[model samples]
Structures are given as C-alpha cells and as structure tokens.
Target: MPRDTPPAERGQRLAVYSHSDKRVVLHVRTNAITHLPPAASKDFLLLCPHQGVGEDDPAGSCPRGNTCQYVHADLRGAHRTTPHTKRGAVAGFYQTHLPGSRWLVHLPVDGECPPKLAILPSRCVLVTRATPADAQGSLPTACPHFTLRHRCDRGVRCRYVHAVASPPESGIQPGRCLTGGWQNDPYRAVPVLQSPEFDLTEHLPFA
Candidate 1:
C-alpha cells in the first residue's frame, strides 16, 4: 500500500473545505498542478463544479475534509436524482496538481472526459472548476456551482475546456458539459482562478 508520502515528494495540490462553514480549511501543494492523485483517506470528497452537489451545497464544502467532525453526509454511491444530500465536507486531498485548467475531474475512463481545460500564458494547462467563460472566453461557461472563479499562480488568462449542458446530468453529454470517471473514480483539481473557488482564494487573490 502507499504509505504517507512527504509533502514535497507527493507534489500534489489538495484543497480542504469545512462543510458547515463552506470555508477552505487547509490547502496543500501549490499553483503547479500536474500530478494530482487521490488521497488514501476516508475524508477528502471528490467534486465536480458542473455536477454540483445540489444548490444547497454548490461549493461542495469539502465533504471529506471535516478535520475533527468527519461528518459523512451520507451521500449516495451513484448519481441520484435527489436534492442536496447532507452536505458532506468536500474533499480534495491530492497526490499531485494538474496545473492550469479549471474544473474537477471525476476519474472516469470510458469517454472523452471533456474536462474544463485552461491555457495560461505560462503555457500550462490541466483541469479545474475555477474559470468562467463570461470573464474572458477562457472557460466554456460557468461551472455547475457557478461560484468558483478563474485563478492562476502567474496572473494569466484561463479558459474552460468544456461545460455545455445547462444543468449538468452527472452522466455523459456533448459539447458544453464534460463528463469524467473514465478510468478511476478519483477526483483531481488544477488551480484556475485567484478567487475563493479554490482553497488558495481563502488566503487572498491567487497569482
């Protein structure tokens, strides 16, 4: 099994949000996201901005990063057509950062996995849910949450790789909205904006 790797060795960009407060509790890694791997803990819930956890918990609230509480929120295993569950702490403990891009990846390996890709001036691109098309044409459209923002560590322009289906379906669609979960159900994130959408936003205007 994978033991706890050192912070530097792991090289991941993980974010933790407190469910009850909706605040980014602890953020790991950095602006460089190119490795993002899943955490080996029970906390750390994966998230997709487009596939919001219902309007009540649009921000996800880090279902897995409850720190002391560790509330499960009792979410359904599959994408159920129900209202917001119990608001679990959205988890983002990572093994690496994918860099650039915006929009969370759901770790699927069946279809195109049209992630929300971002092209930064620094020439870095990955996936995340921070960029918005209305801001600059970088993001395809507002994420399902519609709260996250575009952020880059180097003051750059980011675009959304995908996002079409108005109200995301959790299932695969075409054009705008992108579906993940092609290989593993692991969720990954790349810093996109300097806003609170990302964990760093809690610190300040991200680069």
Candidate 2:
C-alpha cells in the first residue's frame, strides 16, 4: 500500500482519469472520498459516474467533453474489470486539500492502473472532520469515502480494506485484475507494490 499522502506525491498530474466528454476531478458537491488513515497507503480513484463528463483543458477548452472513455461493464458476481484495454484507464490520482497529496499509481503490469487505496466500508475519516451516524438503520446521508473500523464475522476485525474503483453496491467490484494474471501476464506472480512501504495490508484480491 502507498503511504497516505505520499500516494499523492507519487502523482505527477492532478487528474485521475477522464471519462465521457467531460473530465472529472475531485468534486466537493457531486463526488467525494473520505476516511483515510495517517498511513496514507490506501489509494482511491475518483471516478465520475457514467455521465457526460466535461473534458475542458487546463486554462483553456477541451476538444471533447470531459467524459470517461472506459467501456461500460456489466459487473457480475466476483467478476472484476480493468482499464488496461480501455482508453481512460486512470494512471494517477490526487488528494484533495492536502499538501503533497497528488500521487499516480503505477500502471498495472498489463496496462495502466490508478494508485491502490484501502478505505473502509462507508465511514469517512477526515484530518479534522467527524460526522455522527444514526441508530438501527443506514449510515448518514453524507457518506464518507473511507472508514477505518469495519465490523464483520468470526471475531475478526476486517478494518484494513482498500477503496477500489468498482461500484460498492456490487461485490467483486472491489477486486481488480492488475499487474499480471497467473499466466502470460507478467505481473500475475509479482506483488503490485515493489517497495516495503506497503506491508500492512492483507492478501490482494488479485493475488
């Protein structure tokens, strides 16, 4: 896993990936991610929905609308997708309102990939922000991108999960096919991160 903020520094650009005609950056109103640990290892991709995103250029105009270029995939049970074959595969990502918070994940051994992120279920952990939850029901309307402590089965603390790009409502969306597969794919056998910076996480879904 990447160090929380260093993940940002690893990024050489500000945009994670541009979908549709319009490009999507960190949104304060429409979209957001949250609840990152001080470790800063969990990387998250800020992806826009399957809408026409504007692709406006920097200090100028975009020839095409900022929309995503990746193909619409029908997520199945335990099925995973990747941006390698897609045009808008996110090569990097940026952290909002934080210094040295722009980092680009290394491309998958196969094609390209955004940085890896480890965010909890629905809780958003902020630097100085905290929101309260309700009783006997769903979480707050304003969902935090990431939470640290996610409770689960067998007296086990499943708190160290990463925030993947797949949709949350669906399962297997959290796991991605990256680096390499167990065959001709070169990255299959290798771990995503080469350095020792990321050792706290659990078995990779890809692994």
Candidate of highest TM-score: 1
lDDT of each: 0.27, 0.23
**Cα lDDT tens digits for candidate 2, 104-198:** 22212112322232322221121112122326422221111121122111111111122223323222111244444323442222233332122
TM-score on alpha carbons, each prediction = 0.20, 0.16
| Backbone collisions counted per model | 52, 46
Model 2 residue 83 CA deviation (Å) reads 23
Model 2 segments more than 4 A misplaced: 1-27, 31-60, 66-202
Query: Which candidate should be chosen as best, given lDDT against the real structure?
Result: 1
**Candidate 1 lDDT over residue span 1-207, tens digit each:** 112232344344444333433322223334321222344243443333222332333224544343323322222221221111112211122111254544422211122232332223211122333333454433333222211222221111222222211222243232222244321321233222222221212221123
